[model samples]
Target: MATEQPRSSGSNTQRPLTSALAQHTQKKQWKDLSTPEKVVTATKTTTNYAVIATGAVLVAAIGYAIVSELFGSNSDTRIFGDALEKVRNNDQLQEIIGTPMMGHGEASSSKRRRNRRIHSQVVLDAEGKEHLLMRFYVEGPDNEGIAHLEMVKDQRNKWEYKYLFVDIPGGVRRAQRIFVEYNKDAGLPAIDDK
Candidate 1:
């Protein structure tokens, strides 16, 4: 007859070497760590924060650039606003097109196209000067017309109008073109700087 041996319970078994190493390397709370371990942990935390802060700053810069380019004083939207103001204030234009004028971009059948983008381009001439050419539409109670504008950068780096005109189509009378500004000496054409 063989003598029966007692079996040890699973809880009394020794953990494997890999499991023991994993437990040894597991991250402890800040207060439980030795001074050297705390230093390494702090360094990793600071690096992670720095990386997150850098990404946030990059996103902010991109957002600012987009907003400034869309709404800044030198932007196409600002140019359209200035041109619309001129059309509204002109006595001849008011007489022909009527008061309470409305200005917009291209004509569209979509009534929700309120924020339509104005057509514009920037070009460089033979004199190495910059020019902004743009087009928009103007409407009134009785008439509607197309407004074309060209602006050049002056010596002070400010935009000055080279030419601005409005063309009104006619049914009973001949088509009329009105010039709000016409600088004959600028001698700059709308050359595409492709």
Candidate 2:
């Protein structure tokens, strides 16, 4: 009988296949690692931590910007809210526009008024005062009108009303204006002035 040869020892005959990017690496104890390998491992760990930290900071910045835009004291949305509150609570406005008044941006055909953008602007005057100007629409069961408002910041950085009024245009009758707050000496003539 011929002598049988073992087939299990095939490392020399069959070489393990690998690609440049996916070469197999064996795990080694820290003490067994070379100086270059240890440095590469540390660098990779630092890079991963750096990427995570950068992502966290970016997310936090975006969150802060959104919050400030919607809820900050000087934000347009906040000013719109304050003006709408004054309009809704005014007894004269309720009498003119009828009860259950609603405020919105420019007139639109769509019934969804919540998404409308309130038209507003902020400027610095020659007197070194900040001015906020805004215009919006108000509607009620009986009528509709356009509201204009101007506010100036006081020495304490608080908003003080310069003028707030509504104009109602009529079809069969003449137009009308209802003043909620007006400061005649602040560059604009009084209503009764010629």
lDDT of 2 by residue, 125-172 (tens): 997778889999999998889999998876557677899999988875
Clash pairs, candidate 2, are: none
lDDT of candidate 2 at residue 168, scale 0 to 100: 88
Scored by TM-score, the top model is 2
CA lDDT, candidate 2, residue 99: 79
What is the TM-score (0 to 1) of candidate 1? 0.71
lDDT of each: 0.86, 0.85
Worst 10 residues of 2 by lDDT: 185-194
- The parts of candidate 1 lying over 4 Å away from their true place are 1-43, 185-194
Candidate 1 per-residue lDDT, tens place, 26-130, comes to 878889999998999889999999999999999999999899887898888777888899889988889889989999988899978798768899999887899
